[model samples]
Target: MDKPDLTRITTLLLDADGTLFPSEEPAFGASAAVTQAFADRFGLTGDFSAEHLRRTTTGKNFRTTAQDLLSRRGISVDSAELEMWVAREKEEVTSHLGEVLLPHPGVLAALRTLNRRYRLAVVSSSALTRLAACFTASGLDHLLPPADRFSAEDSLPVPTSKPDPAIYQSALARLGIEPQQAVALEDSATGVESAVSAGITTVGMVQFVPPGERGDRTAQLEQAGAVWVTESWDRLARDLADSTVVVRT
Candidate 1:
């Protein structure tokens, strides 16, 4: 992959979960319960481990992940039932947001350094409410702020989830910036695809990836067209500061 043209970039679009904030512990537990509920409802049999469910659903929006999970087990449910399941999962997860969600190590310092030199915005596949909750809990909301945050829920008339460029495109349009003027930091394959497809310079963040899985995760991000990958936000912050020398004319 080519080096990101940070010299020309004036804005940073960041992913929320797994990028800035660690995955919520409650959400992980809730997802396991929801997955088991589906298995019981469908009378399917297998080892439904939390890690297994997480791997299956990571990087996907709630409804999409639910559908995929059911489809993988050859279990079909009506739209209302699917909605009910998703709502249950969200309720359980969000209820414990305060106790479970926290910012990743060095993410706040990195954001502070980046915010000094470039316009910062959060572009997340999560719903706006969920994104707000996490940011508020982690105090990242003060830096990114509500006005600069974009979410899958913001894509209206037609829903555009990650792996689609619509959310990133909408963010750029709203921020009044060109794709070339922005750099995106993402942790998941879906998030990388969204930013790369939107014509932004994309960096894959692997700090949150489990130690054993970093190699595969890094390869996945590279395959998704990330221009660069790093496991250290502190290093990335310095690199960005060093590379962003060209002023926007």
Candidate 2:
């Protein structure tokens, strides 16, 4: 597919995990460990789905909300206990976080090139701290410069997040932008839905799901109204190149 016209595009919003890094396995495994720790402390086993839904929908701090929701649902965890459990999750994830981060080859150059032409922001459900660490480890730290990132941490007291479109809208709002003039790049069905619902052009950053995984997230993303679905970073580069996008004069 031909890349979207750069002249017509303004802001660029991105999802962090699979689109910027390698695959979700490392982050997923790290997160799974955190959730397991939450369960262990709370004596709960079935809160995974609930926690996932809460994070995706509300962008709450991962462990904090997991602990809160577990307690609300009658599980035995408390804020103090959750704190210790969070420490464990944090330590474990920090040690292996670097492993999950492998940016697509030439991505730095593409980002640098695009930086000259467009404003970039991260519109992920992930905590800003972890996402910042991943970007630093992957060498995009210089380009992304953690401060520019928009994430769950930015969701504020209410924990509002994606699939509801608030996060993307927040980014554009911060930039003083209109949705029709910007684009949101995502790798998940929920994210695409959130972006499209906000009236922003959405692009699906392709990712891998294990075989026999009943549902197809790509189709779901398309249904949610993505303007493009791709696994190729080269395409993003070419899109930028085609438009000769330069920082607005």
Candidate 3:
């Protein structure tokens, strides 16, 4: 997990929900509807916005965010809640999830280009099933080829999820890679923290911009140790490509 490790980084760890697609809006509109249903089912009041879930979790990891969010609201839920919500609401909002979070343009090209040189892996803290559906729906799953996509369910009895570094570590281990030989792309504070802590190079993709100046996220992400931050998928590809060059040099 040192500088030399980065030079040989041939693994690319990716966050699915927010990073592969976009944030600020639901990947599947149904998620929002289902989320509201949960809020209502729990008798919780107010609109809970995790618009920047991806960008924020990039530092901490997704598990920490989910548990912390629940603890904050006194809501005793687990990662399973997300899966349940998706199963129940997906049918209703299938169009939204399928439509709203369209793949970032040129991302497939980036994936394809990098795939030739890097062993790409999807390391999400979300449920694997749900992510697989979204990826399939968006055609990203097809574009992803045979790369390994890791979620909370596959590793640990649920280590509180992301921002914990557990998923990243699991993905790397599963791929027989070392931390220093991997670079993770995250879109959330939680994710950033997790990857950095794991000693992997972390790049923050600011996929979600707070509504109407409600927050300053980029600065916080940078402070959280995000080595790179940008909105363009192309820039992200180029920045990461440079890492490969670093390795070869």
Candidate with the greatest TM-score versus the true structure: 1
lDDT of 3 by residue, 180-211 (tens): 77878877776788788888888777654544
- Runs off by more than 4 Å, candidate 2: 1-7, 46-91, 155-157, 207-215, 240-249
lDDT of each: 0.78, 0.66, 0.62
Q: Order the candidates by lDDT, highest first.
A: 1, 2, 3
Tens digits of lDDT, candidate 1, 1-249: 558557778888999877787673355666677778777887867755667756655666676766666787787788788778767766666666656776654888888877778888889877777777788788787898889888875554565478878889999999899898899999888889989999998999988778888899899899998888988789889877778455533
TM-score of 3: 0.74
Given candidate 2, what's the lDDT at residue 184? 82
lDDT of 2 by residue, 1-249 (tens): 454565667678888766777535565466676776566655766646433543342323456456455767776645576667656655666567765566555667777777777878888776666786788778888778766688754454544556667777787877788886687888777778888888888887663343333146567667778776765566776755666443542
Candidate 3 overall Cα lDDT vs. reference? 0.62
Which of candidates 1 and 3 is the stronger one according to lDDT?
1
Best by lDDT: 1
- C-alpha TM-score for every candidate: 0.88, 0.76, 0.74
lDDT of 2 at 234: 66
TM-score of 2: 0.76
Runs of candidate 1 with Cα error greater than 4 angstroms are 24-26, 43-47, 71-76, 103-105, 246-249
The superposed Cα distance between candidate 1 and the true structure at residue 121, in angstroms, equals: 1.0
